[model samples]
Target chain A: MEVVIGTIAGILTSVSMIPQLIKVLKEKEVENLSWMMIAVLLTGVSLWVVYGIMREEWPIIISNAFSVMVNITLLIAYFLYKEK
Target chain B: MEVVIGTIAGILTSVSMIPQLIKVLKEKEVENLSWMMIAVLLTGVSLWVVYGIMREEWPIIISNAFSVMVNITLLIAYFLYKEK
Candidate 1:
């Protein structure tokens, strides 16, 4: 039950940015988005990954790893869109 | 060391939304923002709070608790500003 709850939480956090990502991509505008927020979120997710590794928690590790990827993609998109 | 890392991560995640929140409130616009993303993020953060409670992880609890508040504020601001 705990694992189930954790997994649901993990999944939620992991994919929380998808809609935003899609919107940003389609609109090609990121003027409203904050680079600092993205950078800080990346840092937080990275630390969570490390913490998960230390605790040998696979769910945390997996979810945060995916979150890191998503954040990186968003960052790149923000830069690219900003450049246009 | 682990605790320190966790705390840092918590801080980063907890306050990550401030800049965006400020932007949204100041601009009084949320047209670029995705309501679906915000809703999903709220769900995710809420679940994280629950997970933290179950695990007795105060850092997670505290950080996510703050995140929940921030997200809720953003949502409200998004609607209010959106209406304008």
Candidate 2:
């Protein structure tokens, strides 16, 4: 039961950026999306990956690595869509 | 070392939404902020809170609960600030 809940929780949080990423792609509007939020999230998840690697925790590494990738993609889109 | 890394990672991720929240509060522009993203995150962290309760982990409970509050506030602000 805990595993079930934890897995769902992990997956949801890990991919929470996807919706925003899609919105950005379709709408090309990022006026309200905070770059600091994305950057902090990127840093946090990157550190989680490091922590997981250090602890040899595959679950943490995989989940957070995916988050890192998504956030990086979001960061790129933020740059592209941001008004000059 | 792992604990320190994990603690920092946890702190950063747990409070990651704060910058976005502040942006929304100040700008009153939520056009680019996806409700789906915030809703998914709110669900994820709320589950984490439940999992923490089951496992009797105070840190998890406290951190995730804080996230839940932040996400809820963000959700409310999203509704208020979102363009009609």
Candidate 3:
């Protein structure tokens, strides 16, 4: 049950960003996205990574680690497209 | 250290949604949002909440439960605005 629930949580959080991710990619307009927000968010994601590590929770760790990657990609895309 | 990390994780994850939530509420345009997505998301969040309960993880539990509330609200908003 625990594993099942954790898996569900992992999937939920993982897929939650699909819409925004799609929008960002499709529109290629990330100028409205704030740098401060992303910075703060990265910091937060890092902490979650830590939490996952400490707890030995593979689901939490993996999901958050991938999240960091996505967020970084989005941040870079924002910068690259901001002047476009 | 664990507490500190958990707190940071909680805050990071909590604030991460602000931008998206703002966009959805301010624009009142949720037609682009998908019901299947929200349903999947809720199911996932429910699992995370259960994970938090099993682990006695206040940070995870509180954050996800609050997430559920926000998601539900967003879903309702989508439906409401869709009909408008």
TM-score of each prediction:
0.92, 0.97, 0.72
Q: lDDT tens digits, residues A1-83, model 3? A: 88777776787777665655566677777643455656677778778888999989786788888878877876776677777
CAPRI quality of model 2: high
Error of 1 at B4 (Å): 1.3
What digit string (tens of lDDT, one per residue) describes model 2 on residues A1-84? 988998899999998999999999899888889999999989999999999999999999999999998999999989987855
lDDT of 2 by residue, B12-70 (tens): 99999999999999988898889999999999999999899989999899999999999
Candidate 1 per-residue lDDT, tens place, A1-84, comes to 777887887798789888999999899898878788889899999999999999898877888899899999999999998898
Q: Per-prediction DockQ, in order?
A: 0.74, 0.89, 0.43
Off by over 4 Å in 2: none
**Candidate 1 iRMSD, 1 decimal:** 1.4
Interface RMSD of each: 1.4, 0.6, 3.8
Q: Residue A59 CA error for candidate 2 (Å)?
A: 1.0
Cα displacement (Å) at residue A21, model 1: 0.6
- Give lDDT tens digits, candidate 1, residues B8-69: 88788778888889888888878778888888989988998999999998877888889899
Q: Pick the candidate with the highest DockQ.
A: 2
